[model samples]
Target: MKKLTLPATVPVKELAERLSVSGPELIKYLMGNGVMASLNQSVDFDTAALAADHFGFEAESEEAVAEAAPASTRRRHPLLDQSRADPKSLVARPPVVTVLGHVDHGKTSLLDAIRETAVASGEAGGITQKIGAYQVEKSGRKITFIDTPGHEAFTAMRARGADVTDIAVLVVAADDGVMPQTEEAIQHVRSAEVPIIVALNKIDKDGANPDRILQQLADRGLVSSDYGGDVTVVRTSAKTGEGVTDLLDMILLTADAEVEPKADPKVGAVGTVIESHRDPGRGPVATVLVQNGTLRVGDYIVAGQVYGRIRALLDERGERMQQAAPSTPAVVTGLSGVAEAGDVFQVMANERSARSLAEERGFAAKQQQAQPVRRITLADLASQVAEGSVKSLNVIVKAEANGSLEALRGQIEKIEDPNVKVVIVASGVGPVGEADVNLAAVTDSIVIGFNVRPDDRAKAAADTQGVDVRYYDVIYQIADDIAKAIKGLYEPTFVDVFQGRAEVRQVFTVDGRPAIAGSHVIDGRIPRNSICTVLRDGKQIARSRVAVLKRFKDDVREVARGYDCGITLEDFGDFAVGDVLEAYTVEQQNL
Candidate 1:
């Protein structure tokens, strides 16, 4: 047999094209071995190796594969090549900070007060919905603020092993004290191991008590700086803008307390995506904070599973820019797709090589996806527990009704342990189908059906595929079974709640009863039936439902890619243009 030559870099879609298959088919191949990927996703050498094996080919080392390719195809970006310069050679960079707290805590207001911008007036519910990063110069020093979702999105990012935060601005309403979200913010900040700057907001409220807020902070081990503690507590009212400058000054001082990392402008680029979205005009756009190297126009870049040559670069203010360096957040255009938020982005070499490598990777991915996935059995579970291969017990749950499905999924996530993750893949109110079975089979995951039964074909398929399909009527048994399986992994489940945020784009009047709005699909996919808050300008105008979806008026379901579509809201009618809509979903884990 002739030896097959595999390229080091492969574009996933191209590989699918080469095989005359779809991207999802290739994804299924890799997923068969517990590796989850989307059609546009890129796979590395190891993943490609696995794919090659499944395709009956000899796997080559990534380095070896790269050498076999043309030199032009293996070129490296200048920015990435200089990632390790001395700290003294680095330029002063802005401190990336996250503003977090409970609802109505004036988190957005404080940011508005700092930026001197009217962002607060554009958000829904008066709470910051998306993770926005912007820089402001205070007393000749630059400070970057990352407005994280006050809800579950922050936790979701952490759950993905990507902690894209530096400092945390914990905004606690003086009257509200330490509310649920406040504590959650504290936990998230602590989990990221970042420094905290407590902003006692809403002090202008009649019930405001900064002293009580400080006491609450002390209870949470966040002692104030005035009281001889490391954490800085600034009292500021977003309404009156009182003590806001002092807060900025303190932020600069705190930033000075930390050592800065050096940036090698001559080396390869390394950065983090503060935010990313697919714009109709610009394609894949990412607001990237160049951390270690300089980024320039025409640079080929790899961000998460996507790669493309930079077509244009714009600053946070929407101004065109030629280059951006450490700590500067620039919106870069031209990517294979919108990279996931919090994904690390690296500048690559030429576009041809980038595309080639991307294609090879895609081919390898397809091979892996076509392979049969191993199912998780009791024996395999025991071994996985012993070997810690099962850090989380994943489940694809389906139920007879929406309400029961939601409740059961929620309850299952509440099982609590830090080591196990209870993931509900595709949950709907319907009979368990082949799609569910296929997902479970490929993920080595379990299928839990509540008051719902799989069809004979699905059951037979599950059996033939060696998948475990567990039926449950009682919610507790379902929870218990998952809990036991997690225990078998020896790592207790940690029920950490995660939040995701999306922006509303355009609103359409559905039958004139309630309005369905088009939203810029932000951070995560807008799960069907998740509660949504609609904001006109910056204030939350109403709460609504994603009643029905018509993609380009075709009457289909589920919209991604920040695409504009006609959607019907349940029992609501007030929607306007330029109003931000935030849809959030909460995820619970066992810990």
Candidate 2:
């Protein structure tokens, strides 16, 4: 059978030509299959596929074709987009790796086994609370590992900047196999275009089958080297340390050859703040991963608008250190204020220079704050497309729970627009805040809050930074708004106004087509030409416009409370006694 590839939506005539069939023949085929479409009209992927099946051809969409390609042929991931350092001053540095996988897939357990620490007990729910960076010595060579929260919501923070991970160590359970978060992590790692090493964890568990897990990985396009693919798969038991040593060996081997994680240590210190917070005793503290050069005590550094001299540097063990080399994580205490989690920290020549640069940045921030918030509207999307300023709509979503956030993210991801990609930058459980607004402003993203409200400070920051913060109580509304905005397909938004209701007293047929619902206006008033809804036992069953209204054989425009009226529902005849006839008007508003 012939194979045909089509877009998400294809015009009828275009599809006909591709199938070597006439437009009328295609339309007839659709009609035979209970689908109606004109030659110039469009049909969705499902419709096209159905018609193609009838025509003896296998159909696939462009997205499906792209997704079917080997993982090695995929484009470099956006998270791994790090600029190279000066080769003249470059020295071999430990490869910074990140462990990402599905929740409860033993990501933390694997880390604990590697670090030989009990950090999991400190977390609230056995899940990693925040991003943690650690360096381990293997065979006298160091390897930096960034332990990201395995939950799906934390994926947003991983996409902020590149050079974050030189290699991604995907942890998959030997029995449980690849999951939703695993797919999410794969998308991120692919965007970074970094080498991957699979840790088939939980080999000690009952029913564990490493081969089955490898097959699942292969289905996801990650073929292992044991099967002739370049990707390495290491079977490991985080509890028993079985194959754990080999995993480390593979990491070091991959880093030495495939990743070559090196930086210029002789230059000024430049690194990213993996996490930051306020310490009651120390005032402020930032956990930073030095990507280039060296971070030392007494060196004045500027991060965002916060600037200060590094008074002390502490390693992952909380011990004071004098300096942190490239790929090393350090807890620095000396920032003037709390910096952002993803902010880049760079050492300046002196405290004076640092302060000067910070003042300038602070002024710029104030100016941004003075501007009006940038709302994502259809007109804005049109302008952006016209100017070629954007090809994707980057969004950060915050919700009240992980389930809601995940559901919202899934729906948002499915809003297909061939012109613009909908990129959910990050999603987590919480009210929207200043941190969200700050990230949105820097990345030209919008903040979407589901069943959550932003605090006063977050609102103020959003207003100042001109960041768009939209909140929604309904999940479908969020999807609808984004679809309209990105596709330039705005419809009249309707607000239902309660114009009173009538309880059905009896039902009479009119010409066996229209049903007359004899009802009494129990409250308020029921006006003519209003949209009517049939409520059966407090549940709405159908909605239609009021076609006819009468009071004792006199045509009336409305019936007030305590009065009886005869109402004929338009295109609806199903009426039962004890049913309610609700009348309301649709209030349309502009987008």
Candidate 3:
């Protein structure tokens, strides 16, 4: 049979042409396999493989074919060829190591023991504030270590395309065994395709159980070399400073076996920005891992949108360094702006060229930012649910009263899915505020309001941050909506659009009924029976629809701006002079 090579994804027409089959015939074959696609629609490698097999051909991914291809040239170090580096300049560089594990797993303590920095004592609650790269000498060789908080920070950097880690030291507490965060760290390093050396920490404690920990590791597919596996397990106690040297030796051994052994130090310095922040004393500063060449003081450098000549180079200890060599981490000052984590930095020829390059990159970044950012919408969560990757449906609930708040929290927490969990990251009683929206935005959660509404600042923040804000007057509707959304069976079309705001000038009641607000439409027109929130003293007291809208003696559909009108709201009768009435229409969203 003829063999065919294909990319990771190919359109139906393109795949058909490559497989020597007609487009309709390929479509027919795809339909027979229960896949519905047009000729121009793209299909993944597996789908393409099925189609190719039906056409009397064997399909292999382009990557698989390349791996089996004959060598045409000498294999050069992957990092060196980027700079057109001279082979003579290539020499062994220190391996960059990242310490990752669960919180309270002694990762920071182990680093403090190795580097002797006492950083864990100064940190609030012993959690590292941020990730920074530093180097420590083991015997005659040096190894760079990055003190990361957890797997979240680890994967966040890789998502930006920086592949800096050479080896991963997974610190698992002997007593804690395999924690959720430990599993997450393992998953991240495996995805990054780096070598791992297990550091079984906290061995000196009475509760430490190394055997159970090792068994847990074996269960997670990280069997020890004693059991015919490649993983190296080193026992260490950060408190007593035991087996620290052996772990370092194992790191060097793994680096020799895994990382590219040589780098060209004679070339211009190119590195990744580990993390950057504003220093009150030193302006914009960044901890950069020098990957390929020497980074020197006064060198012009450009990282993403920022460019500046380095005024000073400081080590992780705050000590001054004249230059940073390959595999060294330097805290650099004098950047034009704060570079983001994982931004690749390179030394430029001069200030002029660096500024030009920075400006060009800044423009391109802005253009890319125009694309929609990934948000944790119900649709997005539903897809993750299908893949069994979604761990939690985080929610921020805000209701009208404390009783209602408790009720909503109980109902939302009771929702259970075998694949995904429902977690209330934050909940409170009141109108949704800006802080609530911000928390929801960072946590990728939905902000649900029951019998309450969000303020103007929160509304704007939700829109800008792409946060999903839902308002429901009914209590059980919240849980019902979430359940349907997770199963991909529910997508409500009703979306809130701001109508207008009105200020109360008079308060009265007709026929001893609910209080009515005689007000002036200050901004836009207030539609009849639209969602209206009554606010007093800049705080929302009630969220409901306008029960009645009128102008003088004539009942009107809406009251326009610069006009006075009479308005009555549902579920709210208490009216105070100078209270603001905000209106919004519930319209069907296009998508």
Please, what is the TM-score per model?
A: 0.51, 0.55, 0.54
How well does candidate 2 match the true structure in TM-score terms?
A: 0.55
Model 1 lDDT on a 0 to 1 scale: 0.65
- Pairs of residues clashing in candidate 3: none
Clashes (N, CA, C under 3 Å) per candidate: 57, 8, 0
Model 3 — which ten-residue stretch has the worst lDDT?
72-81
- Evaluation by TM-score, superior candidate among 2 and 3: 2
The whole-model C-alpha lDDT of candidate 3 against the native structure comes to: 0.78
- For model 2, residues 1-591, the per-residue Cα lDDT tens digits are 445677899988667645544466788889988888986689999999988888766687778765875433222222121232235666798888889888788988888787753231232234322337877767878888886664222334543332467888999999899875686577556655688899999999998988888888897789999999888999999999888789889999998888787777776677878888998999899888898778899999877679999999987766678999889888898899998766767777677667766665676678767775555444466467556665888788889998998899899999887778888765667888665675665556778889999999888877666676878899998898878767655443568889989999988986666788999999889999999999987899999999989998999999999999999878788899999988998854322
Backbone clashes in candidate 1 total: 57
- Candidate 1 per-residue lDDT, tens place, 289-354, comes to 777668888888776667888888775556678887777777888899877776666665556545
Query: What is the overall TM-score of model 3 with all chains considered together?
Result: 0.54
Given candidate 2, what's the lDDT at residue 587? 57
Clashing pairs in 2: 76-191, 77-191, 77-192, 77-193, 78-191, 156-425, 156-426, 369-464
- Which one is best on lDDT? 3
**By descending lDDT, how would the candidates be arranged?**
3, 2, 1
lDDT per prediction? Answer: 0.65, 0.76, 0.78
